[model samples]
Structure formats: C-alpha cells, structure tokens
Target: MQILDTYLTKAIANNDTRIPWGSLKYLIGEVMYGGQAIDNFDRRVLRTYMNEYMGDFIFDTFQPFYFHHSPDVSYYIPTTQVDAQQQGLPMKEMCLGISR
Candidate 1:
C-alpha cells in the first residue's frame, strides 16, 4: 500500500493520475500470486484472473465486477469497504481452512 501510495503521489504531482493498467496488473499478480503459483499453467491462470479483475473498466459505473459469474456461484465486488469487526465473523471462522 505504501508503494502504491507513493506511485499515486508521484502521479498526482505530475497532474496525471491515470494508472498504467498493464503494469499494475503484472505487479499485483507477481506480488500476490507469484509465490503461490506452482507451474506455468498456474501462472497463466493467475495472469488471466488478474487481467479480468484489474483494469480501467473497473472504474466505469456501468461495468459490473463479478469475481465469478455462474449459475451455482455468483460473486460481485462490494461497492463499499466493510470493517472487519462489522463483518461479525470470528477470526477462526474467517480463516477456517489453515491451521496456524
């Protein structure tokens, strides 16, 4: 977030805050998913998901952000941020799968 904030600050100073979508996508995918990606196929899938989620069109009001669009499991991006406390899920519930 600090790096992103610095990037935003620099862009603002230059009076051009338009984000470079391609670079943003690559950097985010590399940072967030690169280590977890086990193989070429995994990397390709990660890139594809990043391409879908990270784009300028995300800011368009008419564009619908769907993480997954299917008959069985449909998920969309939340319009507003919710506090962790407000979510009412306990820490164990939230991080259910992995034992720490």
Candidate 2:
C-alpha cells in the first residue's frame, strides 16, 4: 500500500497520464470483494485524494472503463484539454496498480 501511495504521488506530481486503470480497478475490486482489505481511513483518504486530483474527469472519463475493468480511460478527455500536445492529460492515461 505504501508503494502504491508513493507511486500515486509521483504519478500525480509528474503529470503522468499513462496510469494502468485496469490494475487500479482490480485492486479496488479486490478490496471490495474481500480478497484484500485496507483500513477504512486509508481507503477513504485515497479515494478522496484521487477524486480531487482527477477532478470531474474521474467520473466523466475514467468511470466507464473503470466500471468495465478496462485500462483505457483517455477517451473521455474533456474537449478543452483534448489536444495531443497537452501535458497532464497524457499522464492521466496511466492507471496505478495495487501491489500485493
């Protein structure tokens, strides 16, 4: 979990948009399915931080693939930020995986 936290922080700091969303979804699913667990506070904090970090994109873009267990969430990019030259948007494509 610490590794996940560190990687998440670095990804956010570097504006890495290539996150492996499938992996993250798997981790969250595991936590939800009783395959793994985290302290409630940790889960809440991570969710809140991620929600804030990604803004509305979390729901508008990522949520669909997230619900489907797919790693591709870049398709939902906001029109204003869709230009290929964008920096942060690229990093947003990368989803973080949870390490066992």
Candidate 3:
C-alpha cells in the first residue's frame, strides 16, 4: 500500500488533473487485490484523483502513460481474479444473472 500512497502523494504534489474515475476504480480494486496486469490503473487513478481534488493547481495537461513505475520490482499478482471480473458491470451481469 505504500507504493499506492506514494503515487497519490506525487499526484497531489504535481497538481495534475484529468484522471478517469472508471480507471481509478479499477486501480483501487487492483491494488487491494495485488494484480499487475492492469497496474497502470494506479497512475490513471492518481491522475484523475488529483484532477478532481486539485483542478486549479494544474499547470498543463499530461498523459496517463507518462507516469511510469519500475517494472522489475513493482510487478504483483492479485490474490484473486474476482475483482477484475466484476469491475464496470452490475452484480447481475458479473454473476451471469444468477439470483442473489
């Protein structure tokens, strides 16, 4: 979680806006589960979170991919695939329409 906190701090410090909420949700989910497939989700979330939280502080527009982290040591495996699978879809869709 330290890595996530650090990234959030950087985004706050840079005053960058334009992060996507959808992507942010995905990122937080990924982080909590420890998945690396969509690790970029973290950068997307911070960018969006900063933008939403500190819009006026932004100096210039920046792309999401520009914020990169070292791949070698940062890669992580999520505890489960359930989180990624459930993202963006309703519980019904995620569960294939099985009655809850």
TM-score of each: 0.56, 0.26, 0.27
Candidate 3 residue runs with Cα over 4 Å from true position: 18-20, 34-100
Per residue, candidate 1 scores C-alpha lDDT tens digits across 29-89 of 7765588889999899788877777887666778776645678554555566645433633
Q: Pick the candidate with the highest TM-score.
A: 1
Ranking by lDDT: 1, 2, 3
Q: Model 2 over residues 9-30: C-alpha lDDT tens digits?
A: 8888999888656556544444
Best by lDDT: 1
Q: Residue pairs in steric clash, candidate 3? A: 17-51, 19-47, 19-48
Cα lDDT over the full model 3: 0.46
Report the alpha-carbon TM-score of model 1 versus the true structure: 0.56
Between candidates 1 and 3, name the one with more favorable TM-score: 1
Model 3 poorest ten-residue lDDT run: 60-69
Per-residue lDDT for 1-100 in model 3, tens only? Answer: 6766777678778986655444445445556543533567756654564444332223343522211136532222233584673363344522222253
* Residue 25 miss distance in model 2 (angstroms): 1.1
Candidate number that wins on TM-score, 2 or 3: 3
